[model samples]
Target: MTFTLATWNINSVRLREGLVAKLLGEEAPDVLCLQECKSPVEKIPLEQFAALGYRHIVARGQKGYNGVAILSKTPLEDVDGRDFAGLNHARHVAARLENGVVIHNCYVPAGGDIPDREANVKFGQKLDYLSEMRDHFRAQRPHKAILVGDLNIAPREDDVWNHKALLKIVSHTPVEVAALAETQEAGRWVDITRQDIPSGNLYSWWSYRSPDWDAADKGRRLDHIWATPDISGAAHSSRVLRAARGWEQPSDHAPVFATFDL
Candidate 1:
């Protein structure tokens, strides 16, 4: 069966409920994974999404902070969110579909502006978070899994608009990139989006600091969809919905999508 799965860091589900509805109507992805929902699970505005035919959902949320969710048109079985211990943040949620495809959604912490861990507590947390993630997946050894979310690090040179210029930047820093790579290797995750669109300049996030983001085009591939090697061959047709970044009051990040023949 071929189906489309999309990941977007909506920034704030409550703020972009309308855009979410719009995306559901327009893109019609079979499964949608969202990060940075910034709303409690109980206040996720499920009714609006339910109206769009996504009747099933599994999420971990907190008020005005990090949250992750999976909305599916197909039925889902909730997977325990406690897989990664010690890193207790509303950063992950997972579900197994009726077809036995497991979807793991996550929102990795954005290491702050400063690259120095000692100078920035957030940067330290980000590194520790990724370390814990690497250990957890290494132990579990996922198979046939689809991992999606705003991973918050742009690992590839092509993933950032000006790689040289952004090398020292938080997301493009060597340390951050190495940490992200370790996690990917541990999980045996194939970056489906990059696997499909392997050439020049791919990005899912633009900083709000830029006045003319589109014209300046300073963006980063912060969001991602990675599948296990077992299901990697099933992945195809990936794209970043760049226009969503131009939508009124849109989130800094846009949706990235991929299709799979499961």
Candidate 2:
């Protein structure tokens, strides 16, 4: 079977349920994984999404903070909700489709302004979370699985608007990039976005702080989609829905997508 998947950080699922519905009604990806939902699981506005034919959902949510959810047009079974680094945040969730394809959705912490651990607790938490992810993947050795999320790290030099200027910045810093690279190596994951689109100033997130985000075009590829090496070859058509950033009250992050023939 062939299927398409999209991953987005909706910021607040409740506040932007309409946008979610609009995407579902329009793009209609077989599976849509969202991060930063900022709502309780039960409070997620699913009626509209369900009405749009997305009957299957697997989510891990917190009242007004980090949350992740996977809504699917086809049936799916919940498999995991991992608290990497033991922070106990609602940051990760996983589900399995009938075709034996497992999707792991995650929202990595946005390491604070200061990347130094001693100076910033959130920064430390972000590093710890990534360390745990590496360790977990090294042990579990996932196969035929795809992982998607607002990883919150722009690892590649071309991923950011200005790599040299942002080198000291949180998301594009060398330490964070190295950490994410280690985690990817542990999982043997293929970065489907770069794999398909190879060269470009690809970005999935534009900071709301920018007054003219579009004209300035200061953005980062903080969101990502990855598949295990075994099934990586089947994946293609990777892209970022850049226009979503210009949507009404849009999330700072846009959606990333990929298709797989399995």
Scored against the true structure, residue 10 in model 1 reaches a CA lDDT of 97
| Model 1, global lDDT | 0.92
C-alpha-based local distance difference test score of model 2: 0.95
Instruction: Give each model a TM-score.
Output: 0.98, 0.99
Please list the C-alpha lDDT of all candidates, in the order they appear. Answer: 0.92, 0.95
lDDT: worst 10-residue window of model 2: 155-164
lDDT of 2 by residue, 1-262 (tens): 9999999999999999999999999899999999999999999999999999999999999999999999999999999999999998999999999999899999999989998999999999999999999999999989999999999999988999998999999999999999999999999999999999999899999989999999999999999999999999999999899999999999999999999999
Candidate 2 TM-score over all chains jointly? 0.99
Q: Which sections of candidate 2 miss by over 4 Å?
A: none
Task: Let me know the TM-score candidate 1 reaches against the reference structure.
Answer: 0.98
Candidate 1, pairs of clashing residues: none
What's the CA RMSD for each of the models? 1.1, 0.6
Candidate 1 segments whose C-alpha is farther than 4 A from its true place = 83-87
